[model samples]
Target: MSSSSTFPRARKPKLGYDTDQVEEFLRVARRAFDGTPAPGDPEVSAEKIRLTAFGMQKGGYSTAHVDAALERLEDAFAARERQIAARLHGDEAWLREARTTAQVVSNRLARADGERFERVNPLVLGYSVKEVDRFAERLSRYFSDGWPIGIDDVRTVTFRAQRGGYRESQVDLVLDAVVDVMLAVR
Candidate 1:
């Protein structure tokens, strides 16, 4: 498929995600989403879409557009997964699993700022403790106080890097779990 029909190009002198890579991935994702994935295809899942990264090239597909599309695709996959689970396990069981995940996430966020997630080495840079803590507070409130926090908010959040700050992978795992729970209940 032509990248132009799939997404707009970045303006000249600007760099965006590699067009060929994104186009091919999207085609594979479409097949996966339709449950017609071919043999030897890389397993495509909602988590895979969330973790996907593309190389950059000048005048390539717009990063923002590609990212937004990916988010929507991930949501579609998540919802499909949720439906399948519910059909297989019953709605109550599915809801129970979601509740358990939410509890675990809330407990993790319950820690004091700068202590919630593991920190990196003194010389290694990680997510800013202050920024992550602030976001954690919001997440905590969303769970404990029923504050409205969209999945997109967590999906798109960015934290500044700091020396000896919270570990990125750990934070990301929690965020992904939160998204899973949110998608489950939706």
Candidate 2:
């Protein structure tokens, strides 16, 4: 009976928001930024607000606004991905664990065929659990500034970065170490 395609448009023009504003934008749907939820729980309310806000009003958005938001979101996601990836790529402890694990894996492959080492450099042989701990300890010594977020923030950040291939166990361990150090300083 109605000719309208959509109902209840966005009250605020998020599309018109500048870059800095978008970066800090939280969907205006949540009542408050309260404490953390339990483990494995989603930030459902916040996520739903964002999705519904854009999706529900998709038809109303100018292509430029949608494009801009999409671009900003993409960049943020990419940066977070790189931040997590860099953990394994250069983390002394992670590299050591991976190297040690790889060495064992590689040796097995090498044993299967004598020329395996020629095709793949086995790094596990070079790693020791002790070595990784020492490096992790050293890493723990470095400090970052700011009103560091709570344990919940650690959980949130970890969960956010997992889509880029970050393992949950690894994130927990690294964050555990980082949080311990930060807490100790306080």
lDDT of all predictions:
0.93, 0.35
Please, what are the lDDT tens digits per residue for candidate 1 over residues 1-186? 556778999988999999999998998999998889988779898889999999999989999999999999998998888888889999999999999999999999999988999999989999999999999999999999989999899998999989999999999999999998888888
Over 4 Å off in model 2, which ranges?
1-59, 91-186
Q: Tens digit of lDDT per residue, candidate 2, span 27-128?
A: 221112233344543453322322323233322434355444443443343344344545757545534544454344333333322222222123222223
What CA root-mean-square deviation does each model show from the true structure? 1.2, 16.6
Candidate 1 pairs with clashing backbones: none
Model 2, position 115: C-alpha lDDT score: 25
* Candidate 2's TM-score: 0.22
Q: What is the lDDT of candidate 2?
A: 0.35
Residue-level lDDT for 129 in candidate 2:
30
